[model samples]
Target: MHENIDPAICPVCGGDNGCALLAGQPIEQCWCMRTRIPKEVLSAIPAERRGKACVCQACAAGSAPARPD
Candidate 1:
């Protein structure tokens, strides 16, 4: 499997943003995290686990693991 890592800077606030969202929350609860995932990798995630796995904007922009779509 792949190991996910968060970004050093927050894509939104441009600050030291760390991993805050969990692996199973509503998309609306963390829109920034979901938007960070790449289309290709997002597709790779299982449909059933999409909502369970999500990454913050910092991680997404950094090309980290994204929530499944």
Candidate 2:
């Protein structure tokens, strides 16, 4: 996504879900529903932003590494 894209973009990869659910499909059909996002990785997000955005595929799938401190 370009600048001025979703601020809710993943803090890890700065990307969006682009999933069917996000496109107005059922939650059960969303890929994230089947995926397991690591708790430690989720903890890296700032408290204020927690639960505010969905981490992209890479972060959710553990492909992308932790963001530097």
Candidate 3:
């Protein structure tokens, strides 16, 4: 038999469960959820500019800037 696990919903915006692995930071009680950047997008961005790019759950859900990364 298989069991289902509830997703980690974001408390702030009610976003679906997500991991913060993308940012290389520990997951806290935050509104942000981490997402991996596409290779194409990463390649397009300069090394210095990479710091400016971020993929947060808030940003994904059109909320707020959760993390600077």
Top candidate on lDDT is 2
Q: List the residue pairs that clash in candidate 2.
A: none
Q: After superposition, how far is residue 39 of candidate 2 from its true place, in Å?
A: 1.0
Q: Could you tell me every candidate's TM-score relative to the true structure?
A: 0.31, 0.68, 0.25
lDDT score, candidate 1: 0.46
**Per-residue C-alpha lDDT of model 1 across residues 1-69, encoded as one tens digit per residue:** 763433433333334434444435564665564564677544554544354444345455654543332
TM-score between model 3 and native? 0.25
CA lDDT of each candidate? 0.46, 0.69, 0.40
Ranked candidates (lDDT, high to low): 2, 1, 3
Clashing residue pairs in all predictions, respectively, total 1, 0, 1
lDDT of 3 by residue, 1-69 (tens): 543322343322333435554335566633343354445433433344344334334435444433223
Sort order, TM-score high to low: 2, 1, 3
Comparing candidate 2 with candidate 3, which one achieves the higher TM-score? Answer: 2
lDDT of 1 at 41: 48
Model 2 Cα lDDT, one tens digit per residue, 1-69: 333334447776666655665578897887778888899778777665566677777887778766553
What C-alpha lDDT, on a 0 to 100 scale, does residue 35 get in candidate 1? 60
Could you list the CA RMSD of all candidates, in the order they appear? 9.3, 4.6, 14.6
Worst 10 residues of 3 by lDDT: 3-12
Please state the error at residue 32 of candidate 3 in Å: 6.6
The candidate scoring highest on TM-score is 2
10 residues in a row with least lDDT, candidate 1: 5-14
